[model samples]
Target: MEFRDLNISESIMERLDEKGFTEATQIQEKAIPIVLDTELDVVGQAQTGTGKTLAFGIPIIQKIQEKIEENGRKNKKAVKAIILTPTRELALQVHDEIDSVNKGNKLRLCTVYGGQSIEKQINKLRNGVDIVIGTPGRVIDHLGRRTLKLNEIDFLVLDEADEMLNLGFIDDVEEIMSKCKEDCRKLLFSATLPKSIMELVELHMGEYETIRVKSKALTTELTEQIYYEVKEHDKFELLRRIIDKEPGFYGLVFCKTKADVDQLMRRLNDENYSSEALHGDMNQKQRELALSRFKSHKIDIMIATDVAARGIDINELTHVINYDIPQNPEAYVHRIGRTGRAGNKGTAITFVEPREFRRFKYIMKISKSDAKKEKIPDVTEIVELTKTNIIGKLKQLIQTENSEDSEDLENYEFENLEIVDELIELADSKVIIDKLISQLFKEELNRKSYGRIGDYGSRKGNDGRDSRRDGRNDRDRRDGRRNDRDRNDRNDRNDRDRRDNRRRNNDGGSRLFVALGSMDNMDTRRLLRKVLEKSDVSKDNISEVNVYRNFSFISADEKTAKQIVDSFRSERRNGKPLIEYAKR
Candidate 1:
């Protein structure tokens, strides 16, 4: 349905046209008329990228405008509505979106959130605003101080209600809703409605219409799902290979944690990749700057955690790389959904470690992800692709330079041509051409780490079989245990590292033993890496790792080996250490 056909005013319709909001999305088409004509509360269920804000905002704006028209300027200046979001970034996003529809003249909005001055927000509320967009915690602070009043608010919107629920904002949300006028038209919009959301609807909403926009699936068909079987340590190396394979790679990469997001982002930036990081630790301004850079194509990659990525507004993206596999199937879908949007084809790639393959299998079963197993492209292949791209750009430039109709021609080309004529006289054409092409090839492919990824050949975990005699319990246990361990490790990282690498010798000559070898798919290199991940055991400590069918032997200090064994004890099956112990 079209926006013009809706009962919205001509001026608003004109504004929509100017902003290119021509057709109503499925949710908007179904919910707009209901909202515009009724005073009843509403529950709109739709995905994040769907136009949920516009659906409710259009009617809310018109209704607020209507109330103002009837009640005089007093209604215009009063706070008539409040929209609550889960995060500060999301609050700002909702505010900007609604303000765009309102044109900021008829309606005033104050967005309050943490990390900003509470005094500033209080003053804005004191000055009387028509609408408030804020996160739950900040909004509650205002409510407690009585600086913001919602008693007269005619509309209360809980956007991203599920996200709020996940963030433990139910009580705060309920309190905020209770403060609104008894007859206020409440609206709850969420991608997924948990039990708590429905409970809120039943408790606070009367005669509310539940408008669900049915999903074709959690993931779209436009996305091609592929997984590369790579070791954990080589994940970054494989990522760079993927980037090199595609000369114009532009995408969002999802990491499991904020630290991971920062770590990957720093590495990418260090390697001269145009990249930015978005996560919870950054203040609103920094997040906005990173987002702005990504949107404007100043950066080609945005490395972000799942929560911080919620506020992303990009419609077209080329790829979504799961640098660390998400434990939740829905999360995997959510991450991939960021790409292959606006009807454009996108690629979603997962770098699955051997240890993670079992969990990946379970996620696939639950989410119905049809991710194909793909081998990471070899270094030679990436180099060849890079060379081809360089030559392709060179050919394109030559074509543009030679064409009379080409307006993109640089004036510098003429000057370069004069120099080229002189060079042609001074040297053989073949030599000059060879050197030029060679220089371009070297410059493009000179990345030192480009060819360093190991070939973890043809490990297909695509059969949905448990890689490690894994069951549902084991899967659940692994997820929960890993999460707990990672959180604990982050808290006392230095202490934990020291503990993991207990008695280290200056010479690094001690040897240790580990159980479960080739049969468990554990090789010398992989076993050594596993030790290093959990311990401060340097590579020098483990000079040679010898693997047998059912056990392995490695080098480590006597106490360091004991500590490594204790560290992985939780991973033990049949009451063995996670990494079995042996005295040298």
Candidate 2:
């Protein structure tokens, strides 16, 4: 049904029209009315990408608007609502969606997540924000710091509740709930109603109204599901071949971990494929940049972990490749759901290792997807496909050029008449075409060789040794030497640092306590990226990044450290500061 029929305010309706959201999805339709008209808490069960954000967002904004109208805008600074998500990406996405709906209505909203400046979030809170969207970790950080007060919160939303439980944020969520106004309306949304979710609801929500929107089967008729049984080591090669064989290929490749995402992206780029990595290890800006590049076609492939890939919406995506299959069948459904959208045909291909066959079958059964086992195309077949694609393009070009009228041709200038005449004299059209095709075949062969996709079989060298084995040995030796050199350099640097510390009594550098670490999916690169993005600190100015469970410390020169503190003292991670001078 139309959103206008739901009695949405003019301001919200206008924003929806601008966003091209005329009809609401099932969850939105069912949940919006209950949220806007009732005082009872809601438990909404729907799959991902079903517009859960706007379902609760619209009503939340409307309620805040009503409160403002009754009490005047002076109460705008007080946070009236908070939305908790399992990941920083989801939090940002929810904030963006709700903020867009609140356009012209003027609701002050802020997003809090780790790997960002906590002080900035605190400042935003201090100035007064109507809504705060954040992850559980960052929310807990703010709660402990007393920078975020929920005593006056009118609405509290737990989005992706099952995910939060999976990530072990249930305790934090319950704690956050305890600090909120006892009468605050709670809304819990999840793809599945796990036992943990039911327990959470029963404990926190009294007499909640349940809304269930049954999701369609995971595999859609518009999407062709296929799987290739390949050795783990050969997966990359197979991926390369598929990309080469498909014309104008754009895909989202899902990996299992941040390390897998990074390594796969590196390998793809090294093979001359345009790609970017998205994982929890990347800070917010990096994640946004990667998504931007993917959307703009600056990169053709987005290599992402399942968690980092959540809440990312892109149209015109042709395929979803499971570089590593997800353990959860529901996750598999979500990954493939990124494509085959809006009636456009899409393909989902999963690379199944031999050891994973049983699990893969379980996934197929649970997802109800009729995935056919597909054989990987050999290099020769890929080369032939490439040739056929090129010839098809050439034919189209010829047809377009020849389709012009004789009068149009008469108006064209013959800039190279003699060159054409000489070519015609040397060779007939068939000979010329044959020569061109030969050149294209040779070029495709050369490219395949360069990409190493053509070297699936073993080859022997002139010295009676396998060339592949020799290559591996050479690479191992190089890696060993590099490791040795790095070890030696690290030892020398440690020695120098010890001597310097003794001389300066540890006064030469300062340490800062950042409120992010392993729990927030932070790493050295992400920490460095966050520092560089939020402050003027360079890579060389920061050192000794030691991450812990809930916090981290970094050492820098006194001057640089002071600048960092000054820049980030008002910033936050998740919703707390990422840096502070080490407590002496």
Candidate 3:
């Protein structure tokens, strides 16, 4: 049924329409009605992207009729609803969905998750919020700090319950739930109702309604899942070819580490692919900017590590490519779940090194995806793919460009035909394409004389040799190394420090525009001392502290700025702190 049928606000319905959501998925269809009817507990069994968020969110938003009060004003700062997810990513996703649905409504949403300053979250709480969506750890942290008051919570939601269990967050989830009022409305969503989840339901829920919607079952008809075994070294080149050949497809490439994400991003950029990176190391603002660009279709691919991609929900994901196989089956599910959402057709491809074949099989078995194998594309195939991609892009360019003028049309026609002819001659047909692909594969094989994918040092259980090399050299110097080596160590440290200092002090931490009142009542020295005491900053880290008539700014390293943001998040600082990465 339509979102409007759920009796949600008109603005929310409009948002759903804009997001291209019309009919409710099975989970939403069943759970929304039950949730809207009463404050009774709900237990929904469904995988990710089964419209679970809207299922509970619509009811939570509709039913929570609490009066919000803030700062001697009759306003509601006490949250009417709380949603807990296992990861910061999932938490943010749920929060964004709820926010989209509650657009134009008087709901003040806040998210609490790790990999961020808890003090910052506490400050958000102090600013007042009506709904709290967070990870279990951060939520519990807030509870301990007395920043998150759940006693007044009317609705409590446990999303991705199985993930929470798998992540060992069940205990933290229970603790956070215990802080909620006894009569609070409770709802839980999970892919499977394992024994642990059932136990949680039994212990916490009251007169709950149950709804089950199997994601794999629903998606099997519309989606394709496949894996290709390639050498680890060849994955990047393979991904580039696939991206070139896949017409009209927007994709995500998941990497295992932030460094991988950055490396892949740079590679894609250098190769002229419209791409961006997302990782936990990036701040919330950076993550938001990247996501925004991606959603706006400014970027074709997002190279991300899982940690940084928590809480991201993009409905139009056509493909999910595992550049590196996920560490766990659950992660495999999560990564692929980004696609095949809302009853849409999607594809998930995993690149498995020969050594990782067994791990891939295990993941397939655990996830129970209807996965099949794909042969590695040979060199001729890669060349043909590159040609095909160029042709496709040319066609698109011509299609969108204004061709009103005869001369423009003639130029486009000639240019298109020329490109097409060149591509056709390069690899005439599928047979020739395969031949070219094979030839390129052979060339690659010959060039990689040092190692093959399966025989790479990565598969030999060697880790972090790169990180240890510098230390080894340093130790050698301390043990009476040659004069040259000693000189190198001194220069290396200076260079390293210079680079580190540049990254932190891009704009030279000068002044902070603090948002506080009554400068005369504020002591600059005392505030600086307090900031230092509350944060992880050392005295030597700060160069100076400047206080103006209305605000205070600090000069320090980027690390020190982060420390201040973390420490003084809950403290009453006079004015807004300019605690951000300074620009060059």
Highest-lDDT candidate = 2
Please report the TM-score between candidate 3 and the true structure. Answer: 0.53
Model 2 lDDT per residue over 1-584, tens place: 99999989999999999877899989999999998988999999987557788999999999889988888866556789999986665676677679888999998999987656668888999999999998777787788788899998999999888766755566778989999999999999987898989988999887689999886765678889998867665788789888988888999999877888898887676446899999888898988999999899999999998768875798688999999977446678889988898888999999876555554664675466778776677677777788788889887866665456423767655568788778889999799777777765543554324223223222233222343343334222211121133234445657977887554326678888998887888765466557765676654556456667888887887887888888888876777666777787
RMSD of each: 14.7, 17.4, 18.2
Off by over 4 Å in 3: 65-75, 214-224, 227-266, 272-320, 323-347, 351-367, 370-584
How do the residues 402-470 of candidate 1 rate in per-residue lDDT, one tens digit apiece?
466444545334646778889999899999988887665543554433435566654455453544443
Clashes of 2: 19
Better of 1 and 2 by TM-score: 2
Candidate 3 structure quality by residue, lDDT tens digits, 526-560: 55545654674664566545555665566676566
Q: How many clashes (backbone N, Cα, C below 3 Å) per candidate?
A: 0, 19, 25
Better of 2 and 3 by TM-score: 2
Once fitted onto the true fold, the runs of candidate 1 whose alpha carbons sit more than 4 angstroms away are: 75-77, 226-240, 247-345, 349-440, 443-584
TM-score of 1: 0.53
Runs in model 2 lying further than 4 Å from the true structure = 73-76, 226-240, 247-345, 349-381, 384-442, 447-584
* Model 2: residue 246 alpha-carbon error in angstroms: 2.2
TM-scores for all candidates? 0.53, 0.56, 0.53
